[model samples]
Target: MSEQEMFLLPPERPTISHLRMFLSDLAMQYHSLATAALNGDYHTSHTPFFTANGNIVGSTRLRALIHKFNTEFSDYMRGKGEKLKLVHSRFADPLIRSPESIFSLKKKKKASQAKHAGWNGYAIP
Candidate 1:
């Protein structure tokens, strides 16, 4: 594939199978993120292939399948791009369920700080 080439879905119409094929082809073509990024040309050339007119849409089943494949493809690319050293963390499962976890303290601190300010709402800081 040419470095600048991108797989664009038909502008007027696309099918679920088209999306699946696009993502799969994308994953195969760019298994390394550096390669994906390179093939993507830093968002100038390629964007991730799933989207309805570049937004997300479809039946529930199709959407779920697309997301699942996207995640798997991304994970696979990350694995291949060891030079980039991406880390995937499953931080919520164990910590959120455990009372001994210090995460609640951090949350409380943020909440209290939000209260101290004249704001009645919490926002990420």
Candidate 2:
């Protein structure tokens, strides 16, 4: 082999205990990332959350885990589905559907109390 070429063995299969510990650590790391992401959403557009090597986080793996968590959490809440009810709507985009709509006079013409407004609420015809 050339001096620039090197061979490295793959990681060994972890034992059950080691696997548990590794998963626990990974879960904690993921939790911190999610919390930081949520907290930073309300603040500046930047965040200090990065790996020790200064690499950007939130890979496909992280996104998959987030989806999994959301799914599992929703499943867990299925037993409490009876307690929730339809809540009133809230203003989202001012230029789309609000009393103080902005942007332009055309926006005022385009704005409506109709269903096409920007909202996360349940849709009804």
Candidate 3:
């Protein structure tokens, strides 16, 4: 091997635990923003939410994780290195079908199926 090759060190190792922690933080931040949006407090586009080093802190693990996730997900979606792309829809029909609709259907089914608390209430068996 050439001296340049020998001098080049491998990148630091990151494991599934790191990814999981990153995912957990991302989920928390997303949930926060979603709650805010649901409350009619969605941040405006002119606001700093879409910009780098905006109102949010920088140089943090969560930011790095988000950046990494965006890059990887974009690449994955575009089939950058891989030969395939995920066929899942990012957005679903809001009026005709939604997560709430699924939950409503489930509740209706449960109501029709059972009279006891196990099937009618929050408790699941």
Candidate 4:
């Protein structure tokens, strides 16, 4: 097998949680390296990957990749939050349960009773 194929192949499929954890670890390392560079603490031997001023060579591509990841991840999280809010709203009781006027008193009473009759007002049935 080719070197790329060998690297790509794994004995088992990794779980989503594991992949997220791995990415989180990588983000932490990246943050640490960036902070060290900003604080002038980063020191390295002469390498093609870095310049004399401790800046990464070809950093534009890296910045683009980081920006893309941030945008995608933020969008994903926002979508997830919206979905969760939708689901919660589907089963949630109204905050204004009390009757505003005498005309709505009976309806409000019925709704309150029905809410309490279910499992914490969130039962599907």
Q: Which candidate is the best by lDDT?
A: 3
Residue 87, candidate 3: Cα error in Å is 44
TM-score of 4: 0.30
TM-score for each predicted model, relative to the true structure: 0.18, 0.27, 0.26, 0.30
lDDT leaderboard ranking: 3, 4, 1, 2
The runs of at least 3 residues in candidate 1 whose Cα sits more than 4 Å from the true structure, single-residue gaps closed, are: 1-60, 82-125
lDDT (tens digit, per residue) of candidate 2 on 29-100: 777667655554412223444332344443423444577799998998886665534334575443445323
Candidate 3 lDDT over 1-125, as tens digits, reads 99898689654439988777878977988777655444544354323443357666433334455677999999887875655333336584444355566678889888866755556456675
Worst 10 residues of 1 by lDDT: 37-46
lDDT value for model 4: 0.59
Q: Each prediction's Cα lDDT score? A: 0.55, 0.55, 0.60, 0.59
- Candidate 4, superposed: residue stretches over 4 Å from native: 1-4, 8-13, 44-125
lDDT, candidate 1, residue 25?
72
Predicted candidate 4 versus true structure: per-residue lDDT over 1-125, tens digit per residue = 89999899754537988878878977987776666544544343213333534465444234545677999999998877553222235565565343344338668888978877856646665
The model with the greatest TM-score is 4
- For model 1, residues 1-125, the per-residue Cα lDDT tens digits are 65445445334327888788878977876565446443433333334442345545323234466677999999998777554332336854444444444568778899888777874458643
Model 1 scores a TM of 0.18
